[model samples]
Structure formats: structure tokens, C-alpha cells
Target: MLEIHQFPCLSDNYGYLLHDPDSGETACIDTPDAAAYLHAAQEREWQITQIWNTHWHPDHAGGNEAIKAATGCTVLAPEIDAERIPAVDRIVKHGETVWLGEWDAAVIGVGGHTNGHVAYHLPDAEMAFVGDALFALGCGRMFEGTAPQFWTSLTRLKALPPATMLYCAHEYTASNARFALHADPDNAELQTYAEEIRHRRDAGQPTVPSKLLRELKTNPFLRADNPELQARWGHPGDAVATFAALRAAKDTF
Candidate 1:
């Protein structure tokens, strides 16, 4: 079985360790703090075979070099961002699968959070390591990509099985839900979801590994075609436009 554990790094950043106990192989995702994860892995006595990256964000890839130097593991990243990420040994593209023993993940180029951002989806595990792309109840801020591009990418991701568990890079569920509520306060579903999220957060638990089905039901960003959101945006509005306004509100919120 593939056991996935999360390490909370640099306040809200989450670095993941995917371990296949049968194969005894481990893959580390987005090393924001190399020393921290390196130490933890060493203590666990697991072999760190590969380091995977979703984008070139410093917080996401900053610890790549340090961990590589210490562990001598192969680094896998997007081919487009090779210039920014010098440690990339295996430059992968969309449609390629990075095998982890019995489990293999298909890399989908999900740009919009960044120019070269690509999220990895493990179909067998039903997991998505979305770096700064889709959050719990909201999407990542449009930094390097346009709203249309983001919407398209998100649409592709949404096409996946609803049971697919999203493993995003940050722990912004509570805050994201707050913005979600502002976009459609009249949405009782959103209100209830936010309340549950707050309760989980208050108990010091992660409001994550959220299923795509749950997100589709309560998330305003995912619910672009929702009647309530359309009513709030005053009709005939694109979801991207609605999202842009929601993001703006969040910026000041």
C-alpha cells in the first residue's frame, strides 16, 4: 500500500512523503524546507528515491538542492521550467507516467497558478498534488497565468473522478472558505461547509484531502455554473469573471 504523510513546512506549506511500504521506495513532493524533511526521512529509515516538483516557486522547490546533495536522489520536474529549476534530472511532460512501484501517476500540465505549473494525478491512489492551483473551496491566485487558462486547466482537473483526493500545497482551507462565503453568502451549502471547515480547523486538524465531489458541491470556484453565484454576479457572467471578482475581494479580505 502507498502511505502518504504530510509535513507542515514554513507556516502553511505542505511537503508530502509518499511511501510504498511493499517496495520500500519513497518520493518526496515539494521540499520547501529540505533540512526538516531530510531529518524526518532519515529518522524513519526510509529510502528517498526521487524528489518531485509541481512548479518553480521558491517555497516549493527551495529545498530541492539541499536535499539532493544530502540524499543523492533523482529530481523530477516539468520540462518547461528546467531553466529555473537546475536540479531537474528527469524532465517530464503531460501524458507521461512516473511510476512508484505498483502505483503510477500521470502528470497533467495544469498551468495558471504559474507559467510552468503542472499537477500530478495518481489514478490508482486517487491523489492530486496540486501546487498552488486548486485549494479546498477556492483556486490559487492568478499570478503568472490568465483566468481563462486557469479555468481550462481546472476544468480538465474537474473532469477527473469525483473520488479523487486533492493534496494541495498549502493549508488555506479555512481562509479560502471565508472568501467562498463572501462570494455567495446566501449559499447555505457553502455556509455549512465553511462551518465544518472551521470546526476542523479549531480542532487543529487539516481541512484537506478534500474529495473533488465535495468541492463540486460546496466550492464556489468549482461551482461556477451555480445559480446562486450567477445571481450574485448579476447574470450572463462568465465563471472566470466571477472568480476574478472573488479573488479581488479576497485580496483585501
Candidate 2:
């Protein structure tokens, strides 16, 4: 079976280490802090064999070279952003597959946060290491992609199995929940989910690894296509426009 070790790093960033016990192969989901990742792997007695980068942001790929030098692990990055990332042993594009031990992770192009961002989906595990493309009750800022492009990217994620567990890269749920309530105030589901998030944060617990179904019902960004949201946001029948408006509002919220 595959195991995941999630730890906090770089303030709010959540670092992930994907380990396959049978093969003793471990992959760092992203290199936010090399030391933290290395230490986590060492504590688990797992050998680092691969580094899978979802995007080229400094916070996401900043520790690639150090980690690779220390462990001799091959680095896999998005084809479109390989030049921006360090020590990339391979550049993978959308629809490509990468492996760890006997498990295969499909590369999904989810480029709204960044033009080249990708998500790793392990079907058998029913989980995805989504980097910053998505967050609980929210998503990444539209940094490099357009509203239409971002909407399309989100659509792909929405089509995933409803039970798929999303391992997003940040501990931004509490803040995201605040903005979600502001954006979709009448959404009872969101109201309840926000309350739950509040309790989770107060308890010093992680609010990541959010299930897709709950997000679909509560996340305003993911519900841009919903008739109520589209009408309320004044972009009836236009999911992209609704998404753009919601994103713009969140930026300043």
C-alpha cells in the first residue's frame, strides 16, 4: 500500500511525502523546504527516489536542487515550466503517466495557478497531490492563466471521481472558508462546512485532504457552473465569467 506523510513547512505550506512501502521508494510531492522533506523521509526510514514538481513557483520548486543533490533522486516537472525549475530530470506533460514503485500516477494539466501547473492523480489510491492548483473551499490565485483557461482546468478536476481525496498543498482552509461564506452566503452547505473548518482550525488540526464531493457542494469557485452562483454573481449561464468574478472578489476579500 502507499503511505503519505504530511507535515507543515514554510509557514502555511503543507509538505507531502508519498511512500510505497513494498518498494521503499518515496517521492516528495513538492520541495517547499528541502530540510523538512529530508528530515521527514529520514524519520520514516524511506529512501527518496523522485521529486514531482507541480509548478515552477519558488515556494513549490525552490528546494529541488538541494533535495536532488542530497538524495540523487530524479526530478519530474511540467514540460511547459521545466526551464524555470531546477535539476529537472524529466518534463512531463498533460496525460502522461509517472510511476512510483508499482503505482502509476496520471499527470493532469491544471494550469490556472500557473500556466504549466499539473496535478498527480493516483487512481488506485483515489487521491491527488494537487499542489497549489486547488485548496479546501478555494483555489490558487489566477496568477498566470486566464479566467477561461482556469475554468477549463477546474472543469477537469470537477470530473474526477466524487470520492477522490484532494491533497492540496496549503493550510489555507480557514481563510478560504471565510471568503467562501462571503461569496456564497446563502449556501447552507458552505455555512456548515465553514463552521467545521473553524472548529478544525481552533483545534490546531489540518483541514486539507478535502473530499471532492464536499468541495463540489460548498466551494464557490468549483460551483461557478451552478445556476444559483452564476445568477447571484451576475453572470448567468456563463461559468467562466462567474468564475472570473468570484476569483476577482476573493483576491481582495
Candidate 3:
């Protein structure tokens, strides 16, 4: 089985550690700090064989060189932004797959947060490492990809298996939940989940890897077609447009 671990690095940023227990090999996803990555590798006694970069943002790719230097690990990232990332051992394009020990993951291009942002999907495992594309209840602030691209990216994610575990790169769920409740106050699912999240956070725990089905039901970003949100926000022409308005409201929220 593939064991997934979360290493919260550099404030809210998260660097994921995926280990194939049988192989004793680990893959680091978006190492924000080299020292922390090295510490994890040493502590786990797992060989750091590969590093996956989801985007070119420093918070996401800053430690590429440092981690590679320390562990001799391969840095694999989107082909389009390969030049921007130092020590990119492999430039993976859409449809390309990478092997983390014996397991495999498909590379999916998600260019809303950044021009070359990519997400990794392990379909059989029903898991995805989404870098700023889709958050727990919100989505990434548009930086490089346009509203259309961002919407498209999220739609793709929503189409995944409902039980798929979404591992986002930031810890923004609590704040996102606040906005979600405001947008859909009577959503019983949202209210219950929010309370649970509040308790988890109060107890000093991280809120992440939320199930996609839960997001589909409660996250406004995923509820573009919900008549209530559209009625409250003034309906837009399309699903993407409606989602954009909700996102804009969330920016101020």
C-alpha cells in the first residue's frame, strides 16, 4: 500500500510524503524547504527517490535544488516550466506518468494557479495531489490561468471518483468553510462538517485530504450549479461564470 504523509512546511504550505511501504521508497511532493525535507527523509528511514513539483511558485518549488542535492532525488515537474525549476531531472507533460517505487501516478495539467501548474492523480488509489487548483471549500486565487481554465480544472477534479481523496497544498479549509456557510447557510452538510472542522482545528489538527464528495456537496466552488448560490449571487451565463462570482465573493470573505 502507498502511505501518504503530510509535512506542513513554511507556514501554511504542505509538502506531501508518499511512501510505498513495501518498497521503502518515498516521493516528496512540492518540497518548500530543503532542511525539513531532509529531516523527514532521515527520520522515516525511507529513501527519497523522487521529488514532484506541482508548480513554479517558490512556495511550491523553492526547495527543489536543495532537496535534490541532499538526497540525490530526481525532481520531476511540468514540461512547460521545467526551465524555471532548477535541477528538474524529468519534465513530465500531460499524459506522462511517474513511478514512485512500484506505484504509478498520472500527470494532469492544471494551469489556473500558474501557467504550468500540474496535479498528480493516482486513479486506482482514488487520490490526487492538487496544487492550488482546488482547495477544501475554495479554489486557488487566479494567478496565471484564467477563470475559464480554473473552472475547467475544477470541473475535471469534480468528475473524479466521489470518494477520491484530494490533497491540496495549503491549509485554508477553516477560512474557506466560513465563506461556504455564508454562501449556503442552510446546507446541513456544510454546517455539520464546519463544526467538525472547527473542533479538529481547535484541537490543533490539520484539515486536509477531504473527500471530494463532501466538497461537491458543500464547497461553493463545486456548487456552481446550485440554484441557491446562483439565486443569491445573481446567476451568470455559465457554470464557470457562476463559479467565478462565488470565488470573487470569497476573496473578500
Candidate 4:
């Protein structure tokens, strides 16, 4: 069985520690803070054997060198961003598979938030470690990619099984809920989910590891193809145009 440990790091970032008991291999996905990851691993008596980075953003790969120095762990990241992530030991590309003990994780190219952003999808575990690409109720802002490119990336994630659990890097659900309501105001599921998100945040709980099915029902960014949202945003029938309009609105919103 694969055991995942979740903890807060660097303000809103959430760190993940994936442990495979069968082989005693553990991997840290996206190092937001090396000290936090080290402490968490020490508390669990699990040594970090590898690091799977999803992007080259400072918040995502900031702890790479520190963590690698401490654990002598192997670091794997997208080859396209190799120059940005100096600590990467193995360069991975899209459609490649990496093994964590006996479990396999498919590396999916999801370039939107960053030019080389990727997602590590463990189909067998029904989980995905998406960095700043896709979020719980929102998607990442296009920093280095275009709206159409981001839309493509989002569609790829939407293709995953509805039951798949997504682990995003930041704690942006509370704010995302607000935007979702604006874009999908008439969606009953979104209204309910927004309330739930508010309740969770008010109680100081993390609204992460959200189910993909729930996202499909509530996330406006993921529902760019919905005619209602398109009409509400006045983008008519073009999904890409609707996505760009929403994203532009979100840039200032």
C-alpha cells in the first residue's frame, strides 16, 4: 500500500510524502521547504529516497538542493526545465513512467502554469501530484504559457478517471471558491461546495486532495465548455475564448 503524508509548508503550500511500505521507498513531491520535509520525514521515521518535482517554480523546487544534500535522494523533474532546477538528477519527459518501489507513476505533460509543468499521476493509487497547474476549485495563472495551452493542459487532467484524487501545491480553495461562484453562479453543486469550502476554511482545515468528480461539478475553470458559464461571461460558444476571458478576469480578480 502507498501511504501519503500531508503537511503545511511555506505559508499556503502543502507538502506531500509518499511512502511505499512494500519496498520501504519514500518520495517527496515538490519541495516547498526542505526543513519542513526533513522534519516530517524524521517524525515518520521515513527517509526520503527521491523527489518528484512538477515544475521549476521557486516555491516548488526551492528545497531541492537542501533536501538532496540532506538525504542524498535522487531528484527527478521535467527535462525541459532542467536548467531551472539544478538539483535534478534524472530528467523526465512526458509519457514516461517512474517506479516508486513497485508502484508506477506516469509523468504527464501539463504545460500551462509553466512552460515545462508536468503532473505525476499514479493511476494504481488513484492519485495525482499536480504542482501549480490545476487547483481544487481553480487553475493556475498562465505565467509562461498561453490560455489555449492552459486549456489544453486542463482538458488532459479532466480526462483522468472521475474518482482520481488531486493533490495541488497551494491552499487556494477558499479564494477559488469565490471565483467559482462568480463564474458558475447558478450551479447548485458549486454553491454547496463553496459553502463547504468556507466552512472548512473557517475551521482551519485544508481543502485539498479534492476529488476530481467534485471538481468537474464545481470548478468553473474546468467547466469552460459549459454553455452557462460561457453565456454568463459573454464569450458565447467558444471554449478557448471563454477560458481566456475567465482567466483575464481572474488576473485582476
Candidate 5:
């Protein structure tokens, strides 16, 4: 089993440190803040052996050099955005497997947020580190790809095991929940989930690592194909069009 640590960084971003106890191998997933990652590692007496970056966004890969300098860790990044990521010791392609100690994680290409964005899925761990592709009740903006591309990316994510735990890069759940309510106002599950999220935030707790099952029910972005949502939005039965409409609405929401 892997021991994972989640910590806040760079105002709203979250840094994940995944440790494999059997081999004492620790990997930092994305680098929102290099100092924060270093501090967390030092505090736990763990040496960071690897860095798995999901994209080339500054906030996600900003600390690559610093972290590698500090720990001499091998930096692995998506092959598609290799130019943007610094200090990338290795390039990982989609459908390829990367090893973390004795465990392996499959790299899934999830573009749209960034044309080359990728997510790491460890089946044994039942966890996925989705950079900016998917989020709680929301999804990454179409900054580098089209709505259809983002929709396809999200579809792949939704196909993960229902029990999979999604570790998103940011804490945008509260705001996403508000927008989700706007799109799916009559969804009782969303209403309940929003209330719970409100309480958690009010108490200064993290609402991340949301369950795939829960997101499937409450996240509007993921429910674009739902008959009720399509009808409410006056969208034809096309999933791509439905997703495009909702994504456009979210851009301004």
C-alpha cells in the first residue's frame, strides 16, 4: 500500500506526496511550490525520489528544478509538452507505465486543459492524480484544447473505477459546486454534496480526493450527457455539444 500526504501550496493548489512504504520511495505529484514540497518531505523524514508532473503549467511544474536539486529525484513529465517542463529527466507517454517502487501507474492522456496534459492512475492504489483535466464538480478551462477534446478527456476519466479517488490539482470545489448548482439546480445529490462541501470549507477542511462515484452524480461537467441536463440546457442529445455548452457557460460563471 502507498502512504499519501496532501498539503496546501501556492494559495489554492494542493501538493501530493505519495510514498511507497515497502521501498521507501516517495514521489511528489506536481510542484505547485517547491519549498512547500521540500518542507513536507523533511518533516516526514522522507526523501523525494521522483517527481511526476501532469502538465507544463507553471504552478504545476514551477518547482521542478528546485525539487530535483534538493533531492536529486528523477523528473518525469508528459512527452507532448516536453518543452515547457524544466528539469524533466524522463518523458512519459500516454498508455505507458511508470514504476513507483514495486507499484506501477498508467499514464493517461487527458488533454484540453493543456494539449499535452496527462493523469497518473495507479489501479492498485485506486487513486488518480488528475492535473487539470478533471476536478470536483468542475473541470479545467479549455486553455489549450477544444471543448470536444476536453469532453473526450473527461469521458476517459469517468470510465475509471467508480471507487477511484481523484486527487485534483486545485481546491476549486466550493466555487465549482456553486456553478454545478446553477446547471443542475434540481439535483438532490448535488445539493447535499454542496452543503457538505460548504461545511467542510467553513471548518477549514479540504474537500479534495472526491470519489468518482460522487462526482459522477454531482458534477455538471461530467453529467453533460444526462438526459435531464441536456433538456434543461436545450442541448440536442449529442454529448459533445452538451459538454461544449456547459463548458462555455462555466467560462463565465
Candidate 6:
């Protein structure tokens, strides 16, 4: 079994260290903070051996050089964003596979947040390291891709097994829940889920690693194709248009 060590670093970023004990290989999902990642690995007595970068964002790949220099780990990043990311030893495209011991992770192209954003999905672990692509109740902003492209990216994620656990990189669930409720005011499941998110935040607990089953029913961004959402957002039958409207609204909201 792969062991994941999650810890808070920076202001809202969640650092993930994926460990495969059988091969003694540890991979940093993203290099949000080098010092924090190094300290966390040291405390757990795990040697960092690889880095899997999801995008070119500074917060996601800023610590790459430092961590690599310290651990001599190999860095794998999205091929499309290779020019922007630092110290990438391997550039992986969508459908390509990366390995940690005997376990394999598929690279999923999720290019809305950034033009080359990618997600690492481990089918065996039933989890995905989704760096700012899909949030608990929201998706990343359309920084570099079109709504159609982003919706397409999300469609791939929505196709994942319902039991898949989404390990998003931020702690934005509370705020996202607020927007989700506003977007889908009549969704009873969303109301319940929002309330749970509130309680989780009040207790100072992390709301990441959300289940795909719950998100499928609640995340407005992911529900753009639903007739109700398309009608509600005034897009009628266009999922891409509806997604565009929702993203525009959230940017100002």
C-alpha cells in the first residue's frame, strides 16, 4: 500500500508526500515549499526520491530546484508546461504513465488552470493528485484555457471511478461551498455537503481529498453539462457556455 503524508504549507497549499514503502521511494506531489517538504520528509524518516509536478505555477513547482538539489530526486512534469517548469527530468503527456516502485500513475491533462496542467492518478490507490484543477466544490480559474477546453478536461476527471479520492492542493472548500450553494440553491445534497464543509472548517480540519462521488453531485463547475445547470446559468444546452458563465461569475464573486 502507498502511504500519503499530507501537511499544510504556505498559506493555503497542501503539500503531499507519496511513499511506497516496498521500494523505499517517496515522491513529492508538488513542491509548494521546499523547507516544509524537506522537514516533513526528515521527520518521517522518508527520503524524497521523485517530484511529480502538475503545473508550472510557482507555488506548485517553485521548490523543485531546492528539493532536487537536496535529494537528487527525478522530476516529472507536464510536457506542455516544460518550458515554464524548472528542473524537469521527464516530460509526461496525457495517457503517459509514471511509476513509483511497482505502482503506476496515469498523467491526465487538466489544462484549465494553466495551459499544461496535469493530474496524476493512481488507479491502484484510488486517488488523484489534482493540483488546482478540480477543487472540492469548484474548479480552477480559466487562466490559460478556454471554457470548452476546461470542460473537456473536467469531463475526463468526472469519468474517473466514483470511489476515487481527489486530493486537491488547496484548502478552499469553505469558500467554494458558499459559491456552490449560490449556484445550485435547490440541490439538497449540496446543502448537506456545504454544512459539513462548514463544520469541518470550524473544527480546523482539512477538507481536501474529497470523494468523487460527492463532487459529481455537487460541484457546479462539473455539472455544467446537466440540463438544470445549463438552464439555470442561461446557457440552455451548451455545457461549455454554462461553464464559461459559472467561471466568470465565480471570478467576480
Candidate lDDT values, in order: 0.83, 0.95, 0.86, 0.92, 0.94, 0.95
Error of 3 at 125 (Å): 2.0
Which of candidates 2 and 6 reaches a greater lDDT?
6
Clashes of 2: 0
Summed over model 5, clashes come to 0
lDDT for residue 149 in candidate 1, whole number 0-100:
80
In angstroms, the error of model 2 at 141 is: 0.6
Tens-digit lDDT string for candidate 6 (1-253)? 9999999989999999999999999999999999999999999999999999999999999999999999999999998898999999999999999999999999999998998999999999999999999999999988999988999999999999999999999999999999999899999999999999999999999998899999999999999999998999898989999999999999999
TM-score of 3: 0.95
- The CA lDDT at 210 in model 6 is 97
**RMSD to truth, every model:** 1.5, 0.6, 1.4, 0.8, 0.7, 0.6
Off by over 4 Å in 5: none
lDDT of 1 by residue, 1-253 (tens): 7888787899898878888988888888888999878877887888888888988888888888988898888899987766787488898887789977778999888888787788889998888888888889978887888877877788878888999999998899998888778777887877888999989999999887889998888777777766668668764457777666666667688
Give the range of the ten consecutive residues with the poorest summed lDDT in model 6.
140-149
For candidate 5, report its TM-score.
0.98
lDDT of 4 by residue, 1-253 (tens): 8999999998899999999988989999989899999999999999899999999988889999999999999999898887898588899988999999999999998998898999999999999998989999999998899888989989989999999999999999999888888877889998999999899999999999999999999898898998888898888788899999888888888
lDDT of 5 by residue, 37-123 (tens): 999999998889999999999999999999999899999999988899999999998899999999999999999989999999999
- Candidate 2: lDDT of 35? 97
Model 1 Cα RMSD, 1 decimal:
1.5
Which has the higher lDDT value, candidate number 4 or candidate number 5? 5
**Shift of residue 60 alpha carbon in model 5, Å:** 0.1
lDDT of 1: 0.83
Query: On residues 6-43, what C-alpha lDDT tens digit does candidate 2 reach at each position?
Result: 99999899999999998889999989999999999999
Show where candidate 4 strays beyond 4 Å: none
